[model samples]
Target chain A: EAGVAQSPRYKIIEKRQSVAFWCNPISGHATLYWYQQILGQGPKLLIQFQNNGVVDDSQLPKDRFSAERLKGVDSTLKIQPAKLEDSAVYLCASSRSGLGDSPLHFGNGTRLTVT
Target chain B: GESVGLHLPTLSVQEGDNSIINCAYSNSASDYFIWYKQESGKGPQFIIDIRSNMDKRQGQRVTVLLNKTVKHLSLQIAATQPGDSAVYFCAEKSRDSNYQLIWGAGTKLIIKP
Candidate 1:
């Protein structure tokens, strides 16, 4: 079985610039998530989607960060006017169920470096 | 305000020895827990999971022990190998957050040859 797939394994951008990362989740998975993981820290949930609809995005930065799962199979996370603090690994994960029903499959992640 | 954190930031163990990583969670309502292993440049990979009802769960050479009363979780890797060297994180499913998993800072496990 294929795992979650992500694009642009690594990215570098200057402060004030915009950056976007894409994710393609595992087949048949209904739950897709985007997380931001800083160095030496655990991942922080940015947004979550279930079947093309947002399930939760309370932690997302509405001012500059936005995510969408148009077809319920692929997702994209964008950050405009990137800041130095935005440098982190962007991880995409998918699960078959909401919570405990199954484990989340994660992609390798896109390492973003904002200078 | 609920958070999950590890007792140690790093654990060093010789290869072939057993290793134990500990975590503490503050949410009493969290009913599901997961252990994840992440390499230097990779995302977290699921190791094992245990429910609040189960005191312990085992998979292959990994064992997850959950203490609901104390809100403590531990992951045991038997006969630890070099491949086990990575950052280990424990996450708990939040009951108030629509089943969102809250993560810990993670513990880096270093294996000595």
Candidate 2:
């Protein structure tokens, strides 16, 4: 089975610029998630989508970050007016189902470097 | 305010020796836990998991032990190899947080030959 796929293995942008990351989850997966992982730190949840509908996004910075999973198969996370602090790896993951004991499958991630 | 944390930030062990990494969680209501191994430039991969009802679960050469009373979770790697070197993280599924998995900072395991 193919794994979760993410694009632009690495990205570089200037501060106050905009950047976007793309993700295509595994086949038949019902839940997708976006996480931001800083160097030397664990991943922090940014948003979650269950079949194109948001399940949770309380941690997402409403002022600068936004994500959408239209049609429920693919997702995109965007950061406008990026800050230096936003430099981190953005990971995408998927699960068979949002409920129960389904383990998450993660992609290699998009490493964003904001100068 | 609930959080998960590791006892050590880094651990070094000689190759072929057993390795143990520990984590502590503040939420008592969390019932499901998972262990993930993350290498440089890669995302976290699931290693093993154990539900609160089961104190122990074994997968291949890895073992997960959970202590509900102490709110502790541990991962034991037997006969560790250089390939086992990576950052290990423990996450818990909180019942109160809509079953969202709360992650720990992670413990870097270094295996020496």
Candidate 3:
């Protein structure tokens, strides 16, 4: 089966600029997740979508980070007015279902660098 | 604010030796735990998982031991190889977290030839 796919393997932008990352989940997966990983750290969940409806966004920095999974298959994560601290890898993941013990499949991720 | 953490940030093991990585989680309610391996320039890949009901589970070359009483989880890799060099992460899913998995800071595994 095809794994989750992400676009723009790497990105570089100045602080205060805007950037967006795209992701395509595996076929038939019903749940999508966005995560931010800082250097030498684990991935932090930014948002979660269950078939286009948001299931969680408690950890997302709403002021600067936004994500949407329209049509329940593809997702886009955007960072507006990107701060120097926003430089990190943005990852996208999907699972067979949002319930139960299903494992998640992840994409390589978009490495964003803010200068 | 529950969190997961590892005792070591990095571990170096000679090829063909066994490796064990330890993790401690603060959420007692978490019942499901998973181990992930992430190579450089790639995303995390699921390695093995264990539930609170089971104390241990084994995969082809990996083992996951969960100690619910102490909130500790360990991943053991047998006959470590160069391909095993990567960052390992532990994540937990609490019954009340709406299926969200809480991740811990990863441990870098280095394989010595």
Candidate 4:
């Protein structure tokens, strides 16, 4: 089966600019997640979606970051007025059951650089 | 894939030797554990998983050992190969968070030929 697909493997933008990333999870996956990974650190959960409804977004920077998983298939993450601190890899993952210990399938990720 | 700080923790082993990577999880209530391997420029790939009910589980040349008492987990690779070189991370999930996984920083594995 094809892994999660992400577009624009790399992106470079100036500070205060806005950017958006696209992700398509595996077929039949009910849970989708967005994570932010800085260099030398572990991936941090930005948001989690069960089907089309959000289950968790406590860690998300609501002031600048917003994400949505529409139709329970494709998802998008947006960052407005990007800051240098926002420069990091944006990862998208999905799981079959979205419950229990189901293994997560991850995409290569979209690398964002804020200048 | 890229690091801005000091290099990540590294464990180098000779080819054909057994390799052991250790991790300490934070939550005692975590019952499900998973080991993921990630190569440069790629996303993490699942290696093996072990539930708290069991102490050990093996897959291919990899084995995962869980110690609930100490909140520790280890991944053992037999006859490690160059292809096994990558960053390994351990993640844990607990019912309190609806089984959402909490990840550890990762260990970089280097194989010496």
Please say which candidate is ahead in DockQ: 1 or 3: 3
Model 1: colliding residue pairs: none
TM-score (chain B) for candidate 1 is 0.98
Least accurate stretch of 10 residues (summed lDDT) in model 2 chain A?
Answer: A96-105
Pull out the clashing pairs in model 3. none
Model 3 chain A: ten consecutive residues of lowest lDDT:
A96-105
Give Cα-based local distance difference scores for all models.
0.92, 0.94, 0.93, 0.88
Compared to the true structure, candidate 3 yields what TM-score?
0.96
lDDT of 3 at B73: 98
lDDT of 2 by residue, A15-48 (tens): 9999999999999999999999998888999999
Candidate 4 lDDT, tens digit per residue, A1-115?
9999997799999999999999999999999999998875678899999999999999999999999988999999999989999999999999996677798989999999999
Clashing residue pairs for model 2: none
Q: Evaluated with lDDT, which candidate comes out highest?
A: 2
Best by TM-score: 2
Chain A TM-scores, candidates in order = 0.97, 0.98, 0.98, 0.98
Question: Scoring model 2 with DockQ, what do you get?
Answer: 0.73
User: Which one wins by lDDT: 2 or 3?
Assistant: 2
TM-score of chain B of 4: 0.91
Which residue runs of candidate 3 sit more than 4 Å off their true CA positions?
Answer: none
True contacts kept of 4: 0.62
